[model samples]
Target: MDPCNRFRMFLVPFVMGIAFIFADVSQALALRCTALSGDDRYSILYTVQAMHQAKIQRQGALITVFEIGGGDPALNGALLYIRIEHNDQAFVWKTGLNVHSIQQLSTGPENTLDIRAKEDFLDSNNMVISREVSYKIHFYLNNDTLEDAIFVENSPKIN
Candidate 1:
């Protein structure tokens, strides 16, 4: 057998294996929000109390907002669990925001889902230690995913 033939065989299998692994990982990360079982979805909804939803049809994205309520206003303003779904992939982020509204805004190369909220600066015990401020989180579309674009702009906003 030629040395080159052996090298080709090894490289082909190695490449195929890597591809398979990545394919599985990509699938695993996709459709997570939509794939939630009824029980799990209901559990989250029940525990979280208040929920809101918004959609971006152009980007094939859906966003669900869950307000984690119960604490006193002085102790905390709001904690929100945000789930963003684009096609089959979904991204989740948690932040200290009381969502006032959600809006779709676009300009040039940027298509964004803007979440308007009142943000509370809180302490360890969930107390609002500072003045509440208004914030707009802009989630931009990139390559069919809605997670990375907002990560940089909203890093400080997320708890």
Candidate 2:
């Protein structure tokens, strides 16, 4: 084989490999998320109860219900923030009710919640990458608070 032809053959594959790597990186660059749900434990005064229906929706919402009698009634009526973490990215949404006010928090059979992303974080082309992502949820007592309050739940990656 000619030397120039051999060099061309090697160069083509090398360039193709580089292109493939770039494509993978671009896919990773888009924010991807998986569906997640699990139980959250709440305690008031020495009594602890599990909030079993907690869920984080891929579209941008966290839904969970807190029963009235487990803790202080004031705790149920306070405003809260829901924080979601995916890889190094974080998104926050405000929930109108405190920990105890939700009666039936439903994410449906798929367990997906619908949440509105902030205007700054909107990406029209990136779709939620189901099952290929992992996420964590944190609850805050105040909307302006940066730190998670007493409740944090880590969910299993849904297949």
How would you encode candidate 1's per-residue C-alpha lDDT over 101-143 as one tens digit per residue?
2222221124443444443343445344443233344565566
Worst 10 residues of 2 by lDDT: 114-123
Query: Which residue pairs does candidate 1 place in steric collision?
Result: 31-88, 75-127, 75-128
| Collision pairs in model 2 | 57-113, 60-115, 76-100
lDDT over C-alpha atoms for residue 41 of model 2: 24
Q: Deviation in angstroms for 119 in model 2?
A: 29
lDDT of each: 0.49, 0.35
**Model 1 poorest ten-residue lDDT run:** 100-109
